[model samples]
Target: MTLDALRLEVPDILQEDAASLADLNEQLAEARLQPQEHALQQVLSLLFRLNRSAMTLLERQRALQSFSEEYRHYAAAYCAGVAPPILFVRFCAEIATGFKRLLLQILQGRQPSRPHLAWCLYMAQHFLAQSLLRHYQLYQEPPASLWRDSHLLYWLGEHQECLDEPVAAAFQPQPANTLRGLYQQMLLLALSNPFHLAEGESPLLFSALAPLASLARLLPWDVDDDAEGQTVDLTESQPCLAYDQAPEGDSHYLRRFELGALLVALHEPAPLQSALERQLLERVRHHWLGRQQRRHARSDHAGDCSLVVGLTAIHAQLLEHRPGHCAAQMLDTSPGGARLLCHADQGRLLPVGQLVLLLSSSATPTLALVRWRHLNVEGLHLGLRYLKGLPRPVWLRRAPSAQTHPGVLQSTPVQGGGWHHGLWLPNEQFVEEENLWLQLPNVHNQAALPLPAPNLATPLVARHPLKLA
Candidate 1:
């Protein structure tokens, strides 16, 4: 499909590149030998395309299941020590790739049934947490994105299950530092009923109201919340709930009548009950308002620097071929979102509301929602809201800008290339998700580079530095 034909319209309707993706999937399925690395990437690219397509929920589930099963087999073999190293590596990478695509879909507000969502979530957790994590410590140059992304996926699965079932955990009163923690806290804030905290609320009320907990999960802080059904505004005469005789169309109302009734009973209550209710409301307010305010917070860094940002489909684009990375100029970043400038060609294709992965040296790759786009004299400016995560603390310095090359684990590139003056060093600690670097020092003296013993030496690359030359 032509690139211009790939523009993502609001209320996303992605153009399917089904023929090419199907062909790639067919090739992958039929391959008997250990497929090449490019083939693995092709499969991942195809999976991305499929998720972006306008497939029905069942169709998407079936297709995803088929791909998940295929990779699981490879993972099983790799764990068994039978699969080739290349195949195993590809399996690990593809699992991360698939999970990211799944998350982007979720960010787009694609609602699948609980069972189907559970199945997909289960597969993702199995691949990333249960399988890939076991081998994560072994890689010398792992993708830093994996550490944070995996945690997010794990929490999403856990959250999906716990929304209806007994919550396996409670909200800690502590501030959340990570994206996973923030989401975990949000789930608890949104789904936990404050009235249930009373010691003797009565087993009868809890038992009768159990089902409502499943269907009426409410986010009291949401902006679209009905004014009449707001929790804080509940009264004895006008409880914040749709009555039993309410119209069928009002059934989806966010107000939980059962919970609201209990809230009214405890509204003027014993100190303990009042305190618990206050605490719940405080958390809800904090997170809700925090989300809005963080989006526009100030940043100290320059907004026009070249930041290494990863890009997936911001909605869906018809690419003749998938590009390795997106070149985006960092415009501005707040705790909640970022503004980026990109070439018109790339920016025009991204649809507002689509999620994309933005990677940088300062922080792990973030899943961000496209909120707005505009063309001006400067370029195509895109606004992105970070999804369910906060950026790293502002005080922590971002790594300085430098050229980087991705290398295979435990291996180094050959010498004689650009930036040879700097040694290939592993992180002070062996972090499986951070990449090894070929750093160039300002001194430019070859003798200053750390030359480890042969056994410890990494592969070196030999390319002339164009500017230096």
Candidate 2:
């Protein structure tokens, strides 16, 4: 279904990007022989369409299957040499769109069976190797013998621990220096479900491919932790952590799954001796080592205090929660932003790059962007970065006066604390308890503030211009 049918709004940036790509497509069409900007637009357009469109769990899966089938046809044609140059572009487009869709589906609670997962992996490898081959042929001035020592196969061979036995064997049949063997190996790896095999399952391929693991740890698996799926209720509203059901976690684990994979490759009985492979390995090692020194600092204390965040109009579909604001507990604070944990069973929210409104009692609402998200058994640990300098509330900005701090008004903290670990209420009474209260900074002021919570226990139901003593 279209975005309109799901009542989802499309972002202007996406539309502009698509429009720019359309212009590029026209240019490419004019110069048929020019491989200047081959298929980048088509790949991105497919991604945009898939993300913007709202479909049921079933429909999304089916759409991905269709793309996979289309990719298979292209792969076959390309193998036969009868495939046109554009077919390579089409194949990559399908690969990009299909792989991204599969990831999003997993986030939205669609678990693929083992066979289906295998198919996806196969398709990913086939398209990726071909795309690289095509890029070198058309864009780069590579030597004719480049195919004799396919760098792509060399790259895949190092990560055999991630491939199932059947998939690994797929590579053995191909003679050295052939692309077909590498493609066949990856395809077989995708077709085989080594879920039952201890060494075969690596569902976190995206993180391995990520540029950095420290700041953007996409998804990490706890080898011993249960992998059961969490039941989500899209219609239910999550109570504040004060209501007692908040998930618990002090620090987000920051281990490099790729680093672990790399170590295995290094320890292999027959390590890669190729100069090119050695150079790539050394580069990757140095890069990750540098990342280790640049880790973000996290605070140890965000105790009992929760940070209330609201969904802003200028957000992507990534973090769109049910109709209104949702509350998140601060796990820790960093110099630029903070890490928070929110109830995931309420439905997955907060993908990277989503903008959210951070409401602080003493300060103005801070706008933050989701930088990273780690899904766990408890919920999602989101890493956010504030967009601008932190602003103080109007009252905090002005000198405190006796008239503004009436005793009666000060006596009653609008709401008592709830079961949430970090309970934020509408009044300052609970402020000393490491709890945060939200309200207009100025009591005498009637202006509508950009923040959401007031000094009342029922801020969720409270209106603007809250009444204070």
Candidate 3:
């Protein structure tokens, strides 16, 4: 069926001069005046209408480019903390709908020009990537409808022999040439467990995946194919299905992809340009190819606990006995980590990598890191990894003459099984390779400790583990 037969009639404003860029600018200016969420909805609707009304492929591509630009603006705002989470999610959904409709329009009967076809496919892949990112951020499953649409698009692209056609968009850092590259990129990012990333890091990791995606490979799957890994069932309306657990029946739509090339690229030193990039690559390797198994097994646990978020709040609660605790329910637990559920409002303050204190009636207060998080209709779900040893409140400074800052002193097990002490201080107070003075509670003397490079750092805090003689 053709998209035109399924689409609603274009609005009056778009019918006459849908190709006119000036009209679009004017309408967008008016949209900016409305509330952000409402404004985005209107803008997206107008852009799609413009695309639908276009008489030529050039006009449609122009409209799509404009759509891409406006989407980037809102995405940046959400990442910068200027826009609310609800608006970000709505923006993703609207853009995905717009892209799907436009792609269907492009794929109809008459073959489009190569450039236009490539651009549409590229944008479709981009839209899918963003949708996956939204799901990762929300800790929700990607809608099956989205996967169905994506599979259909890929199937059609393959039939047209345009899956690898190259297209360059101004917003992208590099040319997006292949639908398979983008598809594999999305899968790699998903396997990386992006919910564990700190705020503002997801976008960077997404960008990094663009260049490396080409190294990954996707192939048709057969029942006899002996690859003992994950498989993509193009016909299944599911997200991230496993190879072994695929449906009992065989179908031509089954496919498999390998990340060997990508893993080799990650292992090379040259591809890692920054520490953060290196860390993200390491995580991808660990999740996809590394043989490291979970250190501790988890069991179902049920109880309520009090939680305090952030290094500042934790320090205040521990040292000053301040009232910053929020109620949370334990869902499951292990010696190494625990999963908890809390109200969304409380979860907002606890981003991934955040330092939180868990207090329960049966045990003493425990320190943990926010390893991952998800929000849904019920509430916020948190995955926490416990920090070793009991934490004691301490005052830290560069020197005795310098101003003191609140910090936590804790001991963690070293590789050979000895305890090593570290200080957790707010990000602003941490200095690389500098010596810091620690003032212990009820002690008159302050101890001088050399601050080694932090093994773990987040936007809110840094952990400096000290090596003693």
Best by lDDT: 3
Clashes of 1: 10
| TM-score between model 2 and native | 0.28
Given candidate 2, what's the lDDT at residue 372? 53
* Candidate 3 residue-wise lDDT, 1-469, digit = tens: 2212133222233455445666876777788788777888788667556544644545655666666777766665556322245555545555655555566667674867776766676676677667767666656666766666666666666766767776665443232457767766776776676667777666667667777787876677776876644676666665447523745435566667677777778767664367777776776667653233778999999999978888778887877678578889999999999999999887668888889999999888899888888777778889999987869888887889789888888876678777788788878666676777888788888888777787777777788877644
What local distance difference test score does each model get?
0.39, 0.36, 0.70
RMSD of 2: 21.2
State the displacement of the C-alpha of residue 264, model 3, in Å, after optimal TM-score superposition.
2.7
Runs of candidate 2 with Cα error greater than 4 angstroms are 1-290, 304-323, 345-348, 360-364, 390-469
What are the clash counts of all predictions, listed in order? Answer: 10, 16, 0
lDDT of 1 by residue, 1-469 (tens): 1111012111233765432334545656755354555555666666555555666444555566667666655544433222235444545455544544554455456565665454444344334432222222221123334434443443354456522222221111121222323323322332333221222111222222222223322343343443333331111112222222332222222222223433343334444334534544433332222123343685745444332232223111112133345677886678877778887667434544343657666765565556655554576677776654322111101133444332111112336753321211222322323332232223332211122322221111111111112
Error of 1 at 324 (Å): 39
TM-scores for all candidates: the values are 0.28, 0.28, 0.84
Which residue pairs collide, candidate 3?
Answer: none
lDDT of 1: 0.39
Write one digit per residue (lDDT tens) for candidate 2, span 200-233.
0111211122212112111333435433211111
Superposition TM-score, candidate 1 onto the true structure: 0.28
